[model samples]
Target chain A: EAEVAQSPRYKITEKSQAVAFWCDPISGHATLYWYRQILGQGPELLVQFQDESVVDDSQLPKDRFSAERLKGVDSTLKIQPAELGDSAMYLCATTQGSNNEQFFGPGTRLTVL
Target chain B: AQRVTQPEKLLSVFKGAPVELKCNYSYSGSPELFWYVQYSRQRLQLLLRHISRESIKGFTADLNKGETSFHLKKPFAQEEDSAMYYCALMPGSGGSNYKLTFGKGTLLTVNP
Candidate 1:
């Protein structure tokens, strides 16, 4: 069974440092999503990508966060000057088509000290 | 706007006992409901969807549109069935941009 791939399973960074997380969605998936799961909370949507274009980023903290999927396949999420509040498990998910079931990656746990 | 609610934060059941996880949603348009589960050290995966109308691993969920509920039920729970369950709602635009809203999640523990 093919699964979504994520890099840097765990990351530790000093406050105000920059960090990046990568995600490769399952093959043939067109829609990708980035979510942040804080301790004891459900995953919260940060951004949504329809192919290579961003569809929704209302919840994303644009001041310090950015994401891109240039080829409309894999994606990268970067956080500049990370803060203590940025520590969370970042999860990436993808769907085959619209309204389809989402497959999630193992996630990258970030710890901003 | 769409929202999902899982009332219980944790539920405990013994082996061979029946289990039910409560889920409710609020959406104006037609909604697609789903249940996602995450076992320890494993990625979150879909347990079932309302549209499929299929039972999986002795679990089933019926979409009650009138009541806006999609509770998951499983008979004869096993120890291995312990995990965190989340209820999700897909209320995004069509074609693409299918953003999903998830609930806080309910942790199920089945003891022997």
Candidate 2:
């Protein structure tokens, strides 16, 4: 079975440093999502993308965080000047554009020291 | 606005026991509900969706429109059933821009 792929399974960075995570959604999926899950909490939507175009980024912290899908296939999420509170699990999910359900990838665990 | 609620933070049960994970939602429009589970050392995956109305791994959830709830229930729990369960809500009917709002998850621990 094909599954979503994520890079840098675990990352530890000093406060105010830079960190990046990557995700490749299932083929043929047009809608991709980025979410953050702090310890003891459920995942929260950070951004949503539809074929390289951002659909929703209302919850993404623009000043320090950025994401892009250059070819509308794989995506990258970056956090510059990471803060201590930025420690969390970054999850990437995707849907078939016309479907309500989604498939999730193994998350990248970030630890901002 | 759409919201999902999983009231129980943790539920402990023994093997071969009945298990029920509570989930409720608040949405003005027609909503699509789903249950996602994350087992230890595993990625989060969809356990079931309301639209499918199919029982999976001895688990079932019924969408109650009047009550605004879609709770997951299993008649006989197994040791592997221990995992973190999340209830999600998507209120929009339009396929485009479908965003999922997830609830605080419930951790079910099935003891041996």
Candidate 3:
């Protein structure tokens, strides 16, 4: 079965450092999303991409967070000058269409201290 | 703005017993409802969608437009059913947004 693939299942970084997480969506999926899940809270959308265009990034902390899907396929999420509050599980999900079901990756857990 | 609410933080029940997970949503437009599950150390996956009107793993959920609710139900729970459940909603449109709003999630534990 095809699945969303994520790299670096876990990462620990110091404050003020930079960290990056990679994700590859299921083949043929047109919509991709990145979410941050804080402990004991629901996952919050950070960025969303349709093909190669960004549809939304309102909730993303622009000062420190950046995400891109260069070819509209594989994507990367990066955090610069990471803070303690930046520690959380980053989830990547994709859907064939806007109204279809979404498939999620295993997620990359980041710890910043 | 659209949002989802899962009241219970945790729910515990014995195997063979019935189970229910409450989910409520606040969305003015016609919303698409879904239930997703995350098993221990596993990736989150789709459990059921309101439109499908089908049960999965002995679980079912009915969308109540009047009440703005879609509560998940299982006649008899199994040990394998223990997992975190999240309710999500998608706005109705070209749906090109493809953004989903998820609830905090309910941790269900079924003891054998």
Candidate 4:
């Protein structure tokens, strides 16, 4: 089975630094999602993408965070001036359609000092 | 806005014992319910969805529209069943804009 691929399984950075996470969805998957999972809490949706277009980003902190999937096959999420609270697991998921089940990646664990 | 709530943060049960994880939701419109499980050192995966109504790994969940609950249940639990489980909900009507809203997961420990 083809799974979502994420780079830099673990990252350590200091506050006020910039960080980026990359994700490649399963081939042909049209919808991609980025989520943040804090310790002791479930994953929360940060952004959703339909093909190369953003469908929802209400929860994303636009001032500090930005995500793009230019080709609609891969995506990058960047956080400028990372904060202490940003230390969490960044997860990428993809689905073939709007109502299909999502497949999640191994996730990138971010640690900000 | 839709919200999912899993009341118990932790649940423990001996092997072969019955197990149930409570999940409740507050949504004005119809919604789709799902249960996702994450094993130790594993990525989060879908265990079951209410729309499918299928039992997976001896676990089943029923959507109670009247009570607004979608609780996961299993008659007997095994040690390998220990994992973190999350209940999620998505808007039922929205075409492609629907996003999953998850609850604070329940950590289940099935002891021997």
Report clash pairs, candidate 4. Answer: none
How displaced is residue A84 in candidate 3, in Å?
Answer: 0.3
Best by TM-score: 4
Model 2 error, position A40 (Å):
0.9
lDDT of each residue in B1-112, candidate 2, tens digit only: 8889999999999999999999999999989899999999999999999889999999999999999999999999999999999999886576687888999999999999
Best by lDDT: 4
- Give the range where candidate 4 chain B is weakest over 10 consecutive residues by summed lDDT: B90-99
Q: Compose the digit string of candidate 1's lDDT tens values, residues A75-99.
A: 9999998999999999999998744
* Cα lDDT computed for each candidate against the true fold: 0.93, 0.94, 0.94, 0.95
Winning candidate number (DockQ): 1
C-alpha TM-score for every candidate = 0.96, 0.97, 0.98, 0.98
Model 3 TM = 0.98
lDDT of model number 4: 0.95
Model 3, span B30-94: residue lDDT tens = 99999999999999999999989998999999999999999999999999999999999988664
- The parts of candidate 3 lying over 4 Å away from their true place are none
Candidate 3 displacement at residue B95 in angstroms = 2.6
Every candidate's DockQ is 0.87, 0.82, 0.85, 0.82
Candidate 2 ranges with C-alpha deviation above 4 Å? none
Model 1: lDDT of residue B56: 95
Model number 3 iRMSD: 0.8
- Checking candidate 2 for backbone clashes, the offending pairs are none
